[model samples]
Target chain A: MRRKASLILLALAVFFTALSPLLRWYAFPRLAKIPANQYQDMVLEAKNATLLDYGTMQAKTVPKVTIVQTLKGDVDAAKKIDKTAGRDVVVWDGLSYVQGPDGKMVSSIPERYIFDAHTQDPVHATGEMVDGDPVKRDGIEFKWPFLTQKRDYEYFDAQTRTTNPIHYKGTENFRGVKVYYFEQTIPWTKVPFPKTMPVKGITPESVAKTGTTRWYTTVRKFWVEPVTGAPVYGEELHKEELRGGTLLGDRDKVTAFAGDVKMREDYIKHTVALVKSNRTLVLLMVSYLPWGFLTLGLLLLALSLYLEARSRRPGDPASTEVQEPEPVNA
Target chain B: MRALIAATTGLVLAFALVLTITAMGSPMGKTSPKPLLTTVPAHP
Candidate 1:
């Protein structure tokens, strides 16, 4: 009974293991060819927007764009166009610089612009924060600078050693039309605002500190249409503090993002292909596991039996009884 | 006992060989060049 059970197990292992490769071979091609929109659009967006020196204080933003647009006028016809509209990501560098009043290029603070979801164009924007005042609305308060200010705000208070307005900035390139960039003073406050503004369920107080723990983000970026100047895509990169046991100490880290404005069709197809290939590999691996275990178990049983047979002497009762000793005393 | 073990081993070996042969015969290859479903019919 025990031997039979082992054999059954071995068979199962062999069948499963062998079947894995076949399953992978069949599945990957299908998986790899998934509609390009779902996969490629998000990947392209992620790759395009990233901060340089990600971990350091002195970080720079480098945003790259590779758009796949369908042709309308005189152009190559055979070339594959990613009909996946809204896949193009508009990247705005957070660490860009602008010439300050003293004729020095200073680190930019904050700016705003809207990008279209379908057309992927810059429709509206706030030029730059040239002036503003620090107001205390909620528990926390910071300065809100305007772009049309008379003079650029200074970062340092010479004698007091206090850092002045911390600025945020961004740039937009609207295909041959215009290249717009701006810097502004973004107020870090804790006062909640009425739900009437563009961001409904948010408040000034939520954006108080760099690593403040909250349910949602208080700051965000958006892509807009250049003509109508309406926002198309709005996204916020959120951060959270890691647990105590993790290798990274308690620090603010980007957790997740919501919304994919420029969803492309071709991108999704490409993504499916990659996913299919991975799935196929997994199936193949699983198929072989049972077979591997069975082979090892059987080999072990065979060795044990051989050892037991060899250990007994040829004339010993164990061996001699089996043959029925041939008329020993006859 | 010796005969029983030999028979069990042989049977297992035979079953294993059959399974392997079946697997080999299946049209499984590194790449399956099946046609992809690329388009959806337009809604009227």
Candidate 2:
């Protein structure tokens, strides 16, 4: 009975020791993924920004400008892609809308991004595009991968429709959570006019007919929590221009929009809180549970060995039984 | 009988653990409560 108990304990110790690595490496990769139907929205503000008034063909100073970006997952689209791609994927239909202080529309761009749910790597599928143009994305965008490292990453810019290296600058504590800082600079590139214009009858075709070309450049920055790969805080120094067009008259060029865009205070606070909680959840799989199980397994193993040794000792009564003299009358 | 019970208990515990971890990592079911933006009125 004592030996049986030891065997049971020893089996359990081996089981737990084996389970630790399985949970961390196998289960984590298979189970930890972005959901197919996740939806999120963010609001950013730019104060004292420059926006061009197409009506007057002049740059005007606005007290405030707002950008609202939304990303909604398309479940059906993802399911369809999963069949052919042979892996889990997520499709996010995103829109970025800009508005002036008067609550008037400035520009709106719609995008479709498809990527691997676990790795956040762009997946080129049937409907992946940006600003109504077919694009094959080559790098990360909007979000980073799990366990982001302190190295440069190729980041995609929707406006320029180009991928560039975004360098990791350093580490910093953001709202009591450690985060990695990344920065990307996009050079001035001639981009197409927005498919959606603020003014009626002023379409991209109309702008092009007038010989006006749009140009854009930006310096993007993010403070990303490494564990969850989510940006807790982000900002951009964004600028746009319209140049050499009848729309601009004799002026060489006019600033279409120029501002320092930052996440709203409320959104920043909420994001920090969300990332903090997610960090713990991820750590459980990657660190806490694995190590805890390993430690428990080691302790159980020691106990099992001690019990077996004590039961088998030479002087133990259980091991050596006293012989009873048999009385034979003879 | 005792060995059988111990083995069964270990299997059940292992199954329960994997189930809990997978469920915890799964995606939330709630959708967006409200539309993010109002429809833009046609520009005059």
Candidate 3:
């Protein structure tokens, strides 16, 4: 009976010991992914920014410029893609809307981003586009992959429609959470006009017919929580100009928009809280639970071996006299 | 016989608990709250 008990315990020990690595490596990769129906929004503000007054065809200083960015997961779209892609995929329908201090619209651009839910690699589905133009993305975009490493990543730029290396600077404590800092600088590039212009009848085609083109550049920065790979805080030193166009009259160029855009205070606080909670969940699977199971397995195995060894000892008094005593009683 | 029954019951419960944890930890069937902005409004 003692030997049997020991064998059962030994089997349990083996089971748990095998489970540790399986949970961490196998289950984590397959199960820990971005949900297909996630929806999030953020507001960023730029104070004292320069914005072009299209009516006056000149640049003017604005008290504040706000950019509202929203990303909503398309569940049906993802499900359809999964049927053919043969793997988990996520589709995000995103919009970036810019407004002036008066709450008047400036420009808005729409995007459809498709990627692998686990790896965050671009899936290049049929409907992937930016600003109404079909684009085949090469690398990461708004979100990074889980367990992000300390190295440069090829980050795609919506304005330039190109990918550039976003270099990791170092780790820093951000709002009580350790985060990795990354920076990317995009050089001035001629970008197409927004498909939805602020003024009626002032379309991209109209602007191009006037011999004017839009140029943009930015220095983007993010403080990302490594475990969840989500940015706790972000900022951009962004600038745009309308160059050498009849729309600008005799002026060489006019600043369409220029400011240091930063996430709103309330949004920052909320983001930090969310990332902290998600970090805990990821750590539970990757570190805490796995290690706990392994430790428990080792302890149980030790106890089982001890019990088996003691039961098998020939010098044990109970084992030596047990048979004679039972026969006499019978 | 009672001891064997108890041990078997415990083992089954433990296995079930592990499976439950694995399913809960995954992203499957998890959906976020409703979004504030659904459709982009036309700009003037």
List-wise, what DockQ does each model earn?
A: 0.04, 0.17, 0.16
- The reply for model 3, stretches above 4 Å from the true place, is A318-330, B1-44
Model 3, span A273-317: residue lDDT tens? 889889999999899989998998798889888877888789885
DockQ of structure 1 = 0.04
Better of 1 and 3 by TM-score: 3
Task: List candidate 2 stretches off by more than 4 Å.
Answer: A318-330, B1-44
Candidate 2 lDDT, A72-114, residue by residue in tens: 8888888889899988899988888899889988988889999
Docking class of 1: incorrect
Cα shift from native, residue A155, model 3 (Å): 0.7
Q: Candidate 1 residues A169-224, lDDT tens each?
A: 44454322221222222233222221122233333343332333323222334332
Chain B structural similarity (TM-score) per candidate: 0.52, 0.57, 0.53
Q: Please report, in order, the local distance difference test score of every candidate based on alpha carbons.
A: 0.30, 0.86, 0.85
Candidates 2 and 3 compared: the better one by TM-score is 2
